[model samples]
Target: MAPNDSAQTTEEAKDLVAGRRRATRYIVPVAVAGVAAATIGLVPALAASGDPDLPKITAQELIEKMAASDTQQLSGTVKINTDLGIPSLGGLAELGGGSLAPGGERGESGSAASPDGKLLELASGSHTLRVAADGPDKQKVSILEDTAEYSVIHNSGEVWAYDSASNEAFHAKDDGSGTGPGKEREAAPKDLPTTPKELADEALKAADETTSVTVGGTAQVAGRDAYQLVIKPKQSGSTVGSIKIAVDAKNGVPLKFTLTPSSGGKAAIDAGFTKVDFSKPAASTFDFTPPKGAKVTEADELEKEKGLERGAKNHEDFKGMEDFQGLNIIGEGWTSIAKIEMPGGEGIGAPKDGEVPPEAEKFLNALGDQVDGKFGSGTVFKTRLVNALMTDDGKVYVGAVTKDALVKAANEGK
Candidate 1:
């Protein structure tokens, strides 16, 4: 099932966080960055070596070259393998979030390509088969799983994702939406981290030392010739200074990429292009139709709601029964100030205050003393605290903060 599926979101989040505790998701991200860096930096050196005649190509050029072949409608199969590393779940783990594990099993289907260079087809997975498109960036792929599940219309910078399961569609400016119609390309760092080539350029520029060598070998897959290219990292502390990619010598596409981490781990990713059909794909592949009575919501609003829901769920999961039981009400006609005060005198949670309330400060200080310092490392006084305190006083605060100080202040009843 997809990670976003209702039943799996919680469990997936759990497993993902656990995976991070193992190696911290750095393996794949760094590897990706390293691959680009290594290629960008090492390719030149390789070209400079005895094989001086090999044409000079920029990292971007290489990517374009791989993507450039036969722009006029071509079809093939794609087998994508990604080995990613997740970080520890210390506070940042959930904050940094995690990546979706590439669905297991190879995809098989008759695919087609369009004149505009779009590849569309139905993919067969172990459980559910998804049909999607490889948008302009290739990485900007979209899942066209159920035409009936979502009503997507792209026009004048508007985009929507209507879910058939819940009967609600999320809306956001097309700029943030990938693929789909009228969506603007997002900027980098913010955009899905740059492609491998961009990372390669960055790595090459920053590399302190460079060397060139041609490790010989070639293999044929999908009727394409692939070459083995290896480049080593220069810095001792670098996560991955070395990378190897099996590039399709004939088509300029990559079939395999190997990353060696500085921490002594090995990861190999294989991408297979199968069922190649160069015929022009259908024109309706990009079209989408909405479902009936779907609730429409802006993307940011959905995100805000998701965050709030997650936070509330987290509070229920972590907050002790004693927390709610201990507090009582006071005040005649006064409304309640529900704030999430952490253990330390740090930040407050929900119902953000333009100015810190006196009770919030006291609550944070009092809570701070209890945890002593289990929240985080630099978090000796810091702790994850949610304060939803109500009193006769007109004050409130919520969210992450230092628990110790809050505890201290609350106990003194200051």
Candidate 2:
């Protein structure tokens, strides 16, 4: 082979390997996130023995009241538990740690590394989250781990994150101009979706189309009267059977969220406050000074460098790939499908004859079942609550829905 041809082949091989790794990074999180965020063990309130016949209300009224209810100030200890039903994949724990890629950490922006995102990434395990909120602009979330704690605090025009495990702290200043550390980090605070109200709102965004809401019954959550609002997907192909949320009757705050898969079984994800107080916490709860001798880093510089690197890579790899820039949502709500086109028809690396590189093929095969579809041949990765289909044509369709849902999406798109 000519020298130039040999170099091109070598580059293609490297790209192919990198592409498979990226795909693995992308699919693993999506599949796990489906269950990790919504499926948790029943909280103390819901687990209390004895079913008292609490007043029943229409789902519509409950939703309306919840919308009007206010829970701006409060303190609580939330418990998060998840069971994906698959054997322990050591990599699963890394999901909660941050980036899916090996050694990849999220940007330093307070918003990018939000507490909610971190909590959701945790693998199948039990965790405690302590939250205190004085108002929208003043709030703190601390993840309590064995012998260590990870805390994120947003207060007085500044954002601070400290990880006790490494004794590292990150700081960013919010100048109130929408360009501050927090705003730049998250782009939208609401995107974090940690609160009961926030989670309900997120699910409701896809109501009527992809899911139907109904009041399951009344229950006690966190020693308070609460109503169970059940959200069931309308799509027959979805793997999710329903999501049950216990909303505080007095204040409309969601006290607990539980998700069960379509295949009859126990809850896959359960999260809620085991202890809560409606009163405002002390002013010191939201304050942090970054213990002396702790290594502190300014997020602004880190984010700037990351942004530059991302921009350069995007320009280099996707200069003419305008069609792949946006994502298309095939459906809405719980069963919704997110379709993204790969830059090259064959994805990151396209061998001359359309054969997947041996290494890439081996990697994918180990992760999930390989299936053939009407659109083309691809692999289907499945978990108890989520499924994903990656086609040879460089298209990916994923959802917390069933494998049939993904296949249906792939067929329809074709």
Return the top candidate by TM-score. Answer: 2
TM-score, cand. 2: 0.72
Each model's TM-score, in the order given? 0.36, 0.72
Q: Can you give the lDDT of residue 307 in candidate 1?
A: 60
Whole-model Cα lDDT of every candidate shown, in order? 0.40, 0.75
Q: List runs of model 2 lying over 4 Å from the truth.
A: 1-47, 85-103, 106-120, 177-206, 307-314, 323-326, 348-360
How well is each residue in 118-148 modelled by candidate 1, as lDDT tens digits?
Answer: 1111111211112233433221123333443
Off by over 4 Å in 1: 1-169, 175-216, 221-223, 260-280, 293-296, 303-414
Pairs that collide in candidate 2 are 39-269, 39-270, 40-269, 40-270, 96-121, 96-122, 239-402
Compared with the true structure, model 1 gives a TM-score of: 0.36
* lDDT for model 2: 0.75
